[model samples]
Target: MSPMLDPRRLTPRPIPHLPEISKRFDGVVNCSDDTNIEGWKKLLRDDRPMKLAAGSISVVEIESKVLTTGFLEFDFVVEGTGDAPEIQILCAESYENDMDKGQPRSKDDRTNFRTGKLYGPTDTYFCNTKLSRNHYEPFWWRTFRYLRISVSCPPTSSLIFNSITYRSTHYPLPITTSVSSTDLVDKLHSTSVNTLLNCMHETHEDCPYYEQSQFAMDTRSQLLFSYTISHSDLLARKTIHEFYASRRDDGLLETHFPNPGRGMNIPQFSLYWIFMLQDHMIHFHDLALVKRYIGTADGILDHFAGRLNEKGLVGKFEVEGTWAFVDWVGEWFTPVKGFSSMGVPKAYYEKGAATVNSLVYALALKSAAEMCTALGRNDTTTEYLERAESIIQAVNEHCYDVKNGIYLDGPGATGQYSQHVQIFAVLADAVNGEAARTLMRRTIRERETLGLAKASFAMSFYLFRAAVKAGIYEEVWEELLSPWKKMLDQNLTTWAESESMVRSDCHGWSATPMYEIMREIVGVKSGWNETKIIPRVDLVNEMRGSFVVAGGDTVDVSWGESKQVKLKASKDMEVELVLRATSIHIKLLQGEEQCFSWT
Candidate 1:
């Protein structure tokens, strides 16, 4: 469980230098004016609408003033056709222990689940309201979604308006999106659609794109999105290659880049490139792109392999502390020692989250396995798989915290749910029957665990399946809809940058997984792997999809009209279908795959 943070408790941690970073990077981007700050204060502070649409009372436009996590506050703009509408706002705040570097919980502990109010932008905002209200304010307008502006009126009240009005100090609107049928978004929604989609584009001169020293990480609370998107891969690849060129006498890339243009040194995290490369493969299954990162993957695998001690577990380079693990946010760890803290002592090695080490072990060995497969090197493939299995065994044996039946956050030292631990365990596909069931139970039963409901949006996909495997399909389904419904209530279709859990921005790397859940498993995996499908049509699941896209160089289509589903992966790929009402043949070939899972 999460630890309690009181005025008395003290934990030395890295202070997010966003304000300082802001001032340092000023001129290129100017800070909001005092008036803008006042606007922000009013919006977040008193629930007042600083700017409203001329014809409406509830619909108002707002913008982010402070640059902390990349989210600027936005005002709710409801489009009332004719009459005044009632309004209500729901907000969230990070738990107190969230600010600390060393994890506050041991692997065996549960999330604190306790919430603290955000201390608002101004000192007075913090004071004006109850502590709970204070915690609800944005720290620096980090990205967020599931934002809702509820408007209610009598059936007779017909107040029509064109659109809601907002005051944007920076850009005119925040991220937004068009609503989809499957998603239940209904209230006033996001102002920007790109908030969650921009992470894959987080490149600067030294980022995946520019690799420059002058570019700032910009947002302090922004989470990591490792997948490449659209044209983003081209420059990201260039920056990564060059950064690796000088930095890699050894083969791995850092999981992150720091100091503007510099690459990260975390040996294990550098492996994110492998996962990213795999995602790129899934996108187009492009052999050329797969070949490009093949060498880089092998090098990283080898570098990490070099660090394994006699016991074979990779060390905690991503997080180093007094037995501390990845800081609560899951970034930057001391590379000092493998399991033991460098210069600290052999005993210190006993501390740290076994889950994180499990992640390194998994990432390292899996990357090696995938690289070997891409290279068609059998022996290397066998070697990496064996290594991965070893970690899996160790994880099963030591990391389970078996008596509790739930995976521990990490080593016993600093244990708490930060989302990464729970997510890493789930994604690794390492859990067995009962253990998987336990995890599924915990995912819904516990909301604050590892920020599962807040920060890790993609993590739910795995948890949902795990939950289904555990037999609570309905609850898992609700888990899926809860936030999305919150978004729907706000009239949104795409992923939100941040929900109550993350209470930040929707992420590109994170959001892409939603499609996987939508089409691949529930809907269908149509293209290469060339998933050949026998579509099921009863809607045993709550799927509302009509078409699924599959294939590459040659596309196969899977679609549903009434009850039947079909798949075709060849030139003008085709599928035989039977539903409650329609029977048809679909011709598909765009060198892509589609979904139509209905039997």
Candidate 2:
């Protein structure tokens, strides 16, 4: 059986007062100011309650000042001669235009309450008592920045709005790490942390809103983000085991776990599950943990191995019920007259092998080989490495577009190129060194002109990795982060699901900047056996932060424009400092500070 799930301890916090309020009605209301409603103010005070007449509607908007996940509580009393009154509560991360005007509404200022409107799932309640205080609270917690409540009474009844409050809830994971730099970077870091917090609870949810499912692809990135801030692997371990339990008879794992009903399967997500297992092995360095899931990893790889086509590459998933989701590119969502699949490229619908699917399978094989090497299983390691290399060679031989100087979406896929295939090609080692760098540079620079399919927020984590591997991270940093900067520019307190901003406003996958900021900007790279401090001095002049490494040890690093560097470790450990072209290896003693200058 899987490990016992950890119990969550949530604390209830009071919302002192409402931030902003607006009302539209057709009936009488008792208030000091007709233009300005003081009824909400009465909820805070115990003296006199805000009274609403029959048919009167009041929309009280409350801003928590930050993104939060929690249950809402409100107390009120009813006095009337007719039927019970109805209360409606709507929650949203931000306000938007009531109607889509065929333009990007995400660019509009979210703080201007008068111009935008709030839209989200609404919960309603009916008051039954005549003169006694009635309390109302929802069964499930909601994720929101804005909470709008409207109370309407019958022809003779009225509602005395006594008080309203909300109890904030989370997984109780304390963030011990910290990083700071320019205003934008700092905001990006803090906002990313908030977004991650909102998505994490009993399981690593894709988002607290909409579907609170623990998707494999989303959980992999989220687990890495958790490792940067907090050292506790309780949630990560639980998630890994749960996904392993979701395996089917065909050896393919379900896309998400804890799904009670008929589960959906995404072929690529099963590959991501192996990545999650490898990630746990890297951060925690627990051999027993790796051994436990290594069989499950092999089973998943074996399933893909059996599906290789005549060209020696993993073929398209023709299973009766499965999705081959690579990324959420707008070009892939085009409607086909007879095809049922949407949000996937046309090549995926055809009978050929997809370059992205084969590349991901190859990447997973390499990851599994690393785990096998750790366990001293040389034979298994050799088998996985050889299989991975063969798939990489097959993809290079069949999918490379000589004319465009890039990899195609699939074999014989003319004029169908995407950043996804290119990113995976570099990651899976199908291309390396100068070839990889040149291809990535072209992909980033000419994506718009070439009409290449772009990677949305969910796929950006891999996009950043490909850039780093190509040695062009600093060159394309600004362009890569423009989407997030746009969200901040639009006054978003949390990350949106995608650039489209049509769905969830708080997807944890979009919180990948937290991982990149810590790993790349802070330059604290922790591996399975060693910790490396290689600050990208070119990115920022000065930076400082501490992160939890393997075995629950803390490493602190700080550097400035003077080229002076100071670092310390919580215990005796081996550390490597990469300063430009030179590498200095040192041993850090417990609580001892190591000082040096790069110059």
Candidate 3:
């Protein structure tokens, strides 16, 4: 294996724009309270909308030739004799359809002369002509396919732009991977990858347009997605360093890092930091990097070790006023009748031992144990494993409903359940095989099942993983596509934070489709010494793909027509071809290829 590079030295790889596109003014008209171009067309200049004043306001619609590119920063040179025409540039991903809502869409598509032109970070900005620069760019990059440059200048001022173009930027990693499947599957995969590219900035942002926070839960999916598509671990390593940098005096990690102020504390987010570390080691297998962070992992474990309840489950936050958020579940966050106003139910969140929290803690402990064992810290491993087992026993006895055959949300929860605890149960191996299958079928699989709400975008990753463990790939794919297609129907260019009228249009957590296609559908999982090739032929009749995996090996896999499957690797590599939960081990010299049929 090649020696690992220092991840700290990684820099942003700028993706320069192709030869500039010459865009022409489609028309000069008034667009007010309009959500679609057709809606704007219905309103003429004669209507004299409140915001679109007669001479003071004019919407300059710029249309570019059909050029396919990911949305990034737009550079515009606004040259005007008077007051540098205040401009609001709106970018869109699809111009052919109403999906190009001219600008970012909000629930309230109203026209207000005061703030109507403002939307998120892409709002109106006045160019500084005296600063020795004629061009204007925002603090962050904006995503778009079409640009709606709204220049509102005074009646006496004439405004014209010399050069208006866009420059795309990302981690600049090469796309050393390919996925081939059905047409719809291909589109889904592209959308997922696009979401990841947009979400990744200086640090892994949850979304570029909104919040712009580097959230651990959100970036975890993006990290895994990058490994499959980009085949680089630099960003993942950088993210781990950032999370460790955000560690508090008490050793807890922040929900979002590099905060302007002290970071917001979420007890569960700190636990996810541990999971992220383990996940990175699993994919990259850089022992030096893993060893460097083992102490940080120990610090995190130490923080939680002091908070375990008598029953050995993490109870309430010993650190006062800390948010013990598990997921955005109504049961966890939304107060029941008769509780205090403006706060979540204490029993569900702060007070009792939550099944989700304890299970995740147990999983984290087990993960830490594995990492410790890998690092030759057997004492730490034994300690973590034993503690994890105690918590698991406590969870099964206290949280699991013996009669209902499912886990409760918390020890105090009675009829109150969710897909989260059960999913985590399978992930932690607290439940497996028949028990897990039964739990998922009863709690998660059935559409008519009503007790628990579905997972939010952040938690859906685990939902997918647990479903796979339970051998529910069919249901997993179906469940995965529903929300994604819904977003597509709404013409969302980037993944949404939730399936609602939320402010953030783009989020990294929702970029699950691409990672699943590569990992689950194509089944290319990486390890330090070898890569595991396990394509799920059951999901699709014909599936074929190639990806550069861990240790710099290019793997090509195809399963079709007959049960026979073809596989190949570009380097001397060891591979585990997993089928029906059984692993078939194989090895190859450099540039070797082989084909095998599944029985």
Candidate 4:
């Protein structure tokens, strides 16, 4: 029988950030005085219309006097009523680095430039005198660091703006975590924080610039980072509840939450939903709150469990309309021999389970077992653990090529391989120690030859985790610099959806490096009673940072010298300090501190 728990005791505590205030556009881009108004109008005409550009393509520039967050609404008051006038405003949180800039009529590329700007531009607001109100305001709040406003009226009529206001709105949450380093890690951290803040609203958005949808894969990364940096679970909890609310008839959770208009399904995404709850449990320890969704988790596992074949693998899900998507790149499908572009392997896409999917299933099952154990559901835990072990053994037997020291995409050990399969193997504990180390090294070196699926920002979270877990700290550190710095080089204030040309430039998933910095570099892993600190000191020569773990307790760590590490706890907390091959455990009473050194 499940243990009885009080729901009230599981309510998450508040973490506060300063409230956002309204800020007006710094100044008009092309038109400051009446003389320049015509020029601005002309530029607007040259620019694509709102329906053509997902965002405004060309217009007069308007900057905020100071950069601010939480852009909510825009208000414009037109003085002069000779004839009904129309105006268009383009908004962008990062205008100068915007991908839509200067590409007014670019053909639709599906992601950013999809036909019909239903989502509008990164920031596009339109107002016409149809409503007969002198003041115009949009229905919803927008995000932007800049705006481009254009006014159009009857040739003989005069239009003047008496007042203009841009209101910003967001769940006010303070930036509690801090990171200071001698390298550009701090810049990456700050930018990642900005991305997270932008994507965070009523729910966690994949990217505020584009879809503004809360995706499972994206939310998983944002949720982990939010706990470490924001030190709050309010948004995370809201997101969890939202996803649970999207449960489908077949026991699969929808790919995204607040389902805009139509319902959609992704088989792999449902797996992520399970993992998400596990993460929530680890960070918040609110079993009572999590108990509300045990049915959702069980339903998902039951559905998948029924489909396992003789080899303990879930083959192609024959459910109609089900999208078996694993990641953005098509390489998620088993790659064709001697072919660079990834396509569905007819053998597996129709009859066999993709190794990537199998590993995810095992990991999800493992996570379920942990959640069950926490809730005192020993029976469910045993069932899930057994199923997870079976899948793991099957994966190693079918997917791993002992001769090549690599993992294939599917059964029969296809010559084709991807970094994805191996990464998840480590994460699921299906591979460990020397086996994990060798696979990671080969993944990096044989990347080109194997057509190893390149990880976009979203998958990079697992890729980094697997790399760190393999005890290859230096490589993980070195690998992080390029992808992020490229975004910076492109003048992006936030990480892009992928390095793709026609994708949303600001994506929350790309912010994995921030979580890595706090979790792996500082090495803070929170538990119900004890927090673990296993610093990857080799990654950086000298570093200092602080993060709040599960119980709303702040922990700080710094090491300047080669072999010394210092830690301070804000409250009484038990911590385990792990070195390369050894661990030093300590218990600190209230307001206590400790330092350790090793050679």
Candidate 5:
């Protein structure tokens, strides 16, 4: 008899661009209007189109010389003598249509069909003045070029656009995974895909089927990539605030209710989403979002308050008796009584009662403090701060093992073993010198011990900040930038989902690691608080420069052997220079020369 078929090695269907040249799968442009009116849906309303922001992207087969995608890192340039050029590139390719009807071909069948440019970011501004006339990247599916450029306008509005240019990089377009039901290589993964770029601008409480929740919480967790792509914010305030705006009076805040976890029934990511939203606010200080969700933001606090146990803690809401996102053991954030899938041990979660709840509460409280303070709620601000303090104290009492100088939760001879707890503890600033030091040591030594429940980005940030605190700022750069290095290496551009050490998703929140690397690895601190200057040129040896997100005032700090280190800022203002060691001291005021220990 012939060898039987082995149902293992199944790769998900890859999105096809040209003739049979599929690489690895990435993302897509979703334009489905099936659930437009649903509370949370990706498609725009029937009356008009939804606000699709990403460039209409497709993975077209291209040889090395042909132009492809994006507007950055390309050899060509936009043309504009006196004004910016209006440029738009269209990416179209044949997609594999899995759904088939009225024929012998089943829905599982894969066949190629053509697709064209969908939509891109609204109110796009351009300022290219070099390649306006010859802005085309020819492809195998090369279509006709269309243009209606009119430069002479009302001076301020249309006159600004005079060129169109595209960015070409080593990053290749995604090829869909070709996995079928019969063949299974890895652990079970869901197989319902919509588009690579799934977005929902608005949702209402009355709408049926929490489709927005569906898109976000799907098994793929791919939507989380919105934060990692070009022009992305892995975690955005608007995403969470609008989600909150659609909450019902009963405070149920949407649910997968009947189906539970079968599909992306977001019975309640409200808590998680709100926490993420507040995180962005603190990092970016986007007051527009604060003002938009001021009232709803308070409403979220009320939810936390009402849900707290008699001791002001939440239960592991996802699964009972299980530790949630944070921990409640060792020198930890004192796990609040809440349900979380963020930071629980996979084994510990078998019976539910894993106790890594402390981290979530600490972050939630800190977020609360930030949101409250930003919203001008003085009373709430104080309450949240006190709550955060109390939680820290409680975590110390329960999760911390003072003798061992570590804290963790869960039921076991050794309890929960994690490093993310340490990261969150540092991020929350809830621990002390010795514990922080130990926690930092564990993270530097062991990377993935406790991040099972949390996202990899959480660990990345933890590593970055802990490195800064431990005065290994350069190490932090390597830790934080490692993920991006992998992404850039694999593809010229990053995608929503990844195939790295952790294959979840690429997100704006993940990209924040870049910001952390710039601020912490280089040891740059700002604000009315204490000032810090620890120059780190060591890590730059690994990669080129990176940008700082809406960072504070300009800074100048570095140490080099027989070299003049120049630090420039936006404006030359009064400054303070403090060195970590007297061995290299610099005292410069108002752009004056500061003496350094040049080795």
Candidate 6:
């Protein structure tokens, strides 16, 4: 099915033309204005061109209020000439030191351009000494908060810098959601939106810098977050189709689609593709789209089912050139005898099955079963559920640590514990009710003391899910968000790849707060074609927000001290309100505002 045929799909919007918020110029001469910075400002404000004399080398730096992705554009005029001048445009998320060592530098002041140096991708343009009215713009989009344009001219040529502007580009997603709460929550929400914007271009990239490959796991979370703020699913649909096209002969997906290098696969990431398919079904309700990929889901599950060991738990991927990555916990960075480690748990190398992998398979089976049921394939649905149940049962029996009241990384692998196993245990239904709640509670409380490897930014999404399932989201809300809060405190304009902050500083996987804030704090949950509002009244006294529902309608909600809710919808639909252990159903008429209050 062509995604463009969908009536509900939003049309792409035009990219905006933006001027820099601030500018700085160094070593600039022969301008009409008194100072170089003033000259640049006049060029932006009054359309006056800044002229540079011959034999001058100058740097012009510009800053945006936040991170942005765009095309750098400028016009230049060269009059008297000997040799063509060279201009280089450099973009960076932040200025830093010791970039070669991969060390984390203090970036608390992103606007302090003079303190540090810019380190990122650069584009160079050599001007024509004889040509006039030269317009320069790179073909590829550049992501940055700070941009520097350096111009060097020979002694015989004078250069004229006419104008500089940024033609900002994104997926053209209109943000239909808003959150009005504490300062921290507000900043986190806005920062998350910026981070997601930067990571989204032609595909959902892990980060704008370093590697822009679309990994299944990262794309899954990014799609969910996108659904909460915007009704447009064109990008999501494209991603699903691309991943489906990237399926290998063995029924597993490549680690990241559109990869031109050697073939690589991560067994767990294929399972994430199943989760992505199910997520699409829930938000968009496109049965045709799901039907097209349902067989592919089966192919993936079948491969994992064939790999189950004697204990009924899914074993590690033994295929050559495959990585069994679970999480990026520091303790999981085990050194191999002949090769470098990639943060794979030591238990995976030991003699037993990894609980995280088995649990992830079980979860994917459950998701696939839901899609099958939606497609009216009852037999396939039952088979998938049964398969999932068996894996959950096997994990509970073999991987559970009875004495410690925790699940080990693998069967009989003593002292092997991690937050990933426990998070998945609750998600895959290896445990339930109070047991699940208690397990998650203990997992969070004793993680440091028990030496349990913590979940990084990517796995934290599941960590938050497990918390919500255990009904402890309100209780541990602030604690679970400490990582994001720390990032905010560190003056990070975008989310970091991990708490270590050594790699990419703008990873979309770290934008989980965008989803969590909308779903949990504001309490807008997607239910097929309906909307569920279950605001966390206990934690938040008053809040107001709006988000797009499955039916391509905007639902606005506001609640405050009177325990009153004011809701408005664009179409006639059923809005379910759950408050203080009571469920109330209300019929919201089209184009009418409804108010409900609880004692």
- Expressed as tens digits, the lDDT of each residue in 1-599 for candidate 3 is 77687557765653332232333323222343244344233222222222333246656443333222333333334334456557787664333212245754543221222333333224667755454234565654555434565767665344444334445555555688888878767777877777787777678888765576888777777787787786567668778988888877887877798789774477777778888888888877777888988888888888777777887777777535476666654444444423221223334553366678788888889998999898899998999999888889988878878877778777857777777888899999899988788777776555247477567777787888888888876765776678777766655556667643345556778888887888888788777766787778777777777777876568888778887677877877778988756789988666566878777
Tell me which residue pairs clash in candidate 3.
Answer: 92-145
lDDT of 1 by residue, 1-599 (tens): 56575458664432212221121111111112333444434445455454433333242223222221333333233333344334433222211234445544221101122332221222111111111111223443332221223234334232222222221111221111122223221121221123333232323211111122211121111121222111123433444444344345656443344344444344444555566555555544567766766777777677666655434455444342223223223222235555333212122245433455565457556755765676677787898788788766665655555555555544443333333445456556676466666676675667564343223344444445445455455545645546555543433323443332333323332343343333333434443344433333332333332333333222232333543333334356555333433554555663444444344
Candidates 3 and 5 compared by lDDT, better number: 3
Q: Score residue 19 of candidate 3 by CA lDDT.
A: 33
Residue 203 lDDT in model 1?
A: 39
Choose 3 or 5, whichever is better by TM-score: 3
Q: Which lDDT tens digits does candidate 4 get at residues 1-599?
A: 77697455654444344355765555544433545554444323332112212222233455554333444343333334345455677665443323355554321322221122322364333344444335556666666655656555554333444445656655666666788976577878888887777787777888776678988878888888787786567777778888888888778888888877545466778888787888888777889977998889999888888778888887777546666666666544444322311333333563377788888888998898989999999999999899889999998888787877787778874676777888899999999999888788777667888678766678888888888789775764666558887666655566777753345656888888788778887888886556899888877668787777766778888887757888888887778889876888887676656778877
Structural similarity to truth (TM-score) of each candidate: 0.53, 0.91, 0.80, 0.81, 0.50, 0.90
Misplaced by over 4 Å in model 3 are 1-56, 61-84, 90-122, 125-134, 143-147, 318-321, 334-346, 349-351, 562-564, 578-593, 597-599
Cα lDDT over the full model 1? 0.39
Greater-TM-score candidate between 5 and 6: 6
Q: Candidate 6's residue-wise lDDT over 1-599, tens digit each?
A: 56756478574543332233322222222222346877777776665898988888888766766777777778889977588888888888876654466765645544445456677768888887668778897877777777777888899887898877767776667777877877777888999998998888778899987788899999999999888898778888889988898888889888799789646578889999999999888888889999999989999999999889999998867657877777777677657522323666677778557889999999999999999999999999999999999999999899999999999998888898999999999999899899999999988988987778889999999999999998888888889999888878767789989864466779999999999888987788976767788877777777777677876687888888878878888788898988766788989888788877777
**Model 6, residue 423: displacement in angstroms?**
0.3
Q: Write the per-residue lDDT of candidate 5 for residues 51-155, one digit (tens) a residue.
A: 211222112221211112222211223322554434343332122223244322111101122332221122222434554432333331211111111122222
Residue 73 in model 6: shift from native, Å?
A: 0.8
Work out how many backbone clashes candidate 6 has: 0
Give the per-residue Cα lDDT of candidate 2 at 65: 68
How does model 4 fare in lDDT? 0.69
Compared to the true structure, candidate 6 yields what TM-score? 0.90
TM-score ranking from best to worst? 2, 6, 4, 3, 1, 5
Residue 398 error for model 4, in Å? 2.9
